[model samples]
Target: MHMKAIQFDSPFNIKIKEYKTPTIGKYSLLVKVAYCGICGTDIHIYEGKVPFVTYPIIPGHEFSGTIKAVGSKVTRFSIGEKVAINPNFSCKDYGYDHHEYCYYCKKNRPHFCINWEAIGVTMNGGFSEFIVCPNTSAFKVPKEVSLKEAALMEPIACCLHGLQQIRIRPENTVLVIGAGPIGLMMVSLIEAFYKSKIIVSEPHPSRRNLAIQFGADIAIDPNNEVLKDVIKKETNNYGVDVSIEAVGGTTTAIEAIDCLNRGGKALLFGVSMPEDTINLNLFELYSKELSLFGSFTNPHENDQALEILKNKLINVSELVSHIFPIWKLEEGLKLMKNKAKDVKKILIQIEDNPKEYSEV
Candidate 1:
């Protein structure tokens, strides 16, 4: 069967093209894509900034879909079920020759697999009307979760992994240094899971206001206001216990380090360019006993992300500021790539209504 899909031929080249939709294998399920989210990585791919991405790929790693058909041997998932996708490619798939080859996968950290290739970046992904993937990549979407919010599962899972790395304690002060979707997710996750005082530093006034509305205790305009002064005043000059650099810039990384207290943890959650580098004070890092962690991708955090969405613990719906149909994929990507715009999450709706296409 042929289906309409958005294909990225090369840098700055994207178009809606008709491609053959694969039939499900014994271990695979055919999914009718509901929504695919535009992420920073997608923007990077469009700008030719990401190094590992190959050309002529479908660029959508964060997505939600419904089971349209199931293979004969697929027992875990049934038709009519809604699901979220995990795009990380591991060595546990068909043939499975590299069982002991990768140290990270052997240690139960497939997110750091040696030969990892993602669905959207390196392989055919979910920016289409239909997708057939291994049942392992599909997680059952919770009943209370909306299809639109389910599209955000992959990113939420990534942010959850970042949260695990820094280990925010109750009553601790956290400074999140961006107000984009991922940064705002950090604020909301900290508010819901950490239950701590949160401060946000965003240059955009609209985003700073959003940070406050999304549960930040204080929001500072870094361009116009002194972020260091605000943090000192809020923490009584002690500094924050945890600092998350979500802007993926050298200046924000430096700011995050400067605002951290002694023995504080820093979680670098943003995707930086290959040429980007930040100068850090090695003496201070050693003297203060600071810990630094880098979050690469989503681990086994999709289920928890779905649970949070199902229970309404995090307001992901509020982060969704715009939606576009599949035909308007390029327009959505352009809007998401615009830094001046107050856009959070931009979703490409492949189908009008999931229920109409589902067997249920």
Candidate 2:
């Protein structure tokens, strides 16, 4: 059987070609893809900015689908089950001939695996009609969760992982830099669970308003209003307890660090350029005892993300502003790359009849 897929042959060169449907191994599952969310990392891959990506690869890491076939050894999941994929893979999953696990993987941190490989980043991904992934990498979707919502599980898991690193308390005041989809997810998570005062810094007017709607107590336009000044005013000059940098830029990262109180914790969850650098004040670090953390990818938080979606704790539906067919993926990519005002979460619909699994 043949399937249509979008392949990135090189930077700025994407093609929609018909390829043979992939067969699964004993530990894998063949899934008919439903929806795939375009991420900022996808843009990096498209622009050839990601150093680890190879040419002629299908680029989609956030996706959900229904299983069409399960390998004989895949007893945990059955055929026809709805599932969301965790794209991160360890050396063993990549068929590496290593007797001992990598240091990071051995410590249960596969996101930093020395020989890490991701489904869409390092291998073929869900920008196609079908995808074959290991059963261990797939998590079943709940009855109430739509495949569209499930497609965002990977990113939501990433946000959850970032939050877990900082351990925000209910009494803490939180500031999230950037009102992008990932930033909004962080706001939603903080709002739903922490009950902390949430502030968002975004330059775009529309995104700032959207952040307010997503439970941000104060949405400041960083282009006009000073973030540190607003942080001081909001916290009565104590600064925020937690700051999350979701916009992958050095400027925003510095803002995240500068707007924190003494003993404050900052989570740098953004994906910055490889060569990006920041100038930090060692005196401030020593005086305030600030803690800065870098979050790579979702380690093992997919299930928690799914549960949040299942209970409708976060407004995932509102985050989806546009949907494009697989053929129009490049168009969607361009819109997202340009930071179009209307773009929030751009979903690429792979199946012609995704509604068929609406009840799944």
Candidate 3:
């Protein structure tokens, strides 16, 4: 069988091409994709930032689908089971050093998997109608969670894992720099987990407004007059208890550091560009005993992300402001790259809704 998938052949060159069905490895299973969420990494690659993106490589990682087939050696899943996927598949077969990074695999801290190889980056992913993955990589979606919502597992896992790196108390004041999708997710996650007031700092008015909708008590534009004064007032002049930098810009990174309260924690959750560093006051980092969290990709937090969606703990639905059909793949990429108006959760439709296409 032939599968049509979106792939990058080179810089500024994406194509919807056909490829032969991938053979199921001894531990792998085949899946029929239901939804593939367009992520920020996909846009980064489009802008020529990634290094290992060989020409003609499939790029989707956040997705949910149904099992269609399983390898003869596989027993954990059967055909027809609906599921969402955890994109990170580790090479335990490679070495024990990988376990140091495995938060759960090492000390039963399942939220932090130290040694993991992501599906889309290490191999082709679900930007197609069908793809094959190990049972270990595919997870069962709950009855209450829609496939569209389950498609956010990868990113949700990311924020959840980052949150695990630092413990936030109910009385703590939190701030997030950048109101992009990740920043917005951080806001929702923190609000859902803590009783403290939440604030967001974003330059874009549209995004700042959206932050308010997503649970940020205060959304400030850095360009706004009295921005610093407002942030200081919000924290009662002690600064925020914790600040997360979700936009990977030097300016925003510095802002997060500056906005923290004494002994505050600043988590760098964004994928910063190479060679970009923010100037900081070493004296403050020492006198205040600031903690820095450097987060990179999802580890072992996919399940909590799913639970948040399953229980409707966070108002994630409002974040889905854009959706597109499969044939309009380029349009979706363009929408994200241009940072179009009121854009969040750029979902790529894989199958025609049977209700719309008419059931056979």
Candidate 4:
């Protein structure tokens, strides 16, 4: 059997090609992909900006699908079950290719494993008709969650991990820098779980309004209004208790640190370039006793992400502004690259006739 897939032959070169369908190992599952989200990492790989990515790779980590076949040893999941995949893989989990566990993996931090590999980033991903992944990497979707929404589980998990890093309090005042899809997801999660007084900084007018709609108490246009000034005014000069930087820029990262109160915590959830650097004031750090955190991939938060989606705690549907077929993925990527105000989360529909699943 053959399956169609989109492959990135090299930087700035992508094509749709047919290849023999992949089979599963004893601990694997063959999944018929439903929807795959195009993420920032995908863009980096496409432009040859990600140093770890190799050529001729299929790029898509945020996806959900139905299982068509399960390996004999995969008793946890059955055929026809809907599942979302966690792309991060430890050396051992990648087919046990390496017996020696990395330090981070042994410490229960596979996201930081020295030999870490991801399904889409370091291997073939879901920009195809079908995928074969370890059963351990797949999580079953709840009855209340649609495959479309389930496709967003990966990002949701990432956002959840970011929030966990900050340890947000319900009464804390929080500022989210950027109103991109990831930023908005942070906003929604903070509102739903922490009930924090949420403030958003976004230059785009539409996204600013969207932030407000997503429970932001104040949405400031960073291009016009000063973020620190606005934050000062909002918090009566105390600054926010927590600040999340989701824009993946040095300016926004500095803003996240600068707009914090004494003993404030900041989570740098953005994916910056390898060469990006920031200038920090050591005096401010010493005086305020501030804490800064860098969040990587989702380690073990996929189940919580699924629960959040199943309960409709976060509005994933509103975040999805456009859906493109697999063949039109490049067009979607171009739109995202142009920073279209109307484009939020873009999903690549893999199945020609996707089943009409009920939404939560």
Write down the lDDT of every candidate, Cα atoms only: 0.86, 0.91, 0.78, 0.90
Per-residue CA lDDT of candidate 3, range 88-196, in tens?
6654322346434455565654334545556666568778889888777777889999888888888988998888887888888888888878888888888888856
Error of 2 at 51 (Å): 0.9
Give the Å error, residue 120, model 3: 1.9
lDDT of 2 by residue, 322-360 (tens): 878887889889988887885688899897834321211
Question: Which portions of model 4 show Cα errors greater than 4 Å?
Answer: 95-100, 353-360
Clash totals for all candidate models: 0, 0, 8, 0
Question: Best candidate, lDDT-wise?
Answer: 2
Write down the worst ten-residue block by lDDT for model 2.
Answer: 351-360
In model 1, pairs of residues that clash are: none
Query: lDDT tens string, model 4, 1-360?
Result: 999999999998999999899988999999999999999888889899998899989999999999999998878999899999998887556655434777777777888888778988889999999999988789999999999999999999999998888899999999999888898888999889988899999988988889998899999989898889999999999999999999899999999999999999999988999999999999999999999999988998999999999999988899898888888888878877777877788898897743442221
Estimated TM-score per prediction? 0.94, 0.95, 0.91, 0.95
RMSD of each: 3.3, 2.8, 3.6, 2.6
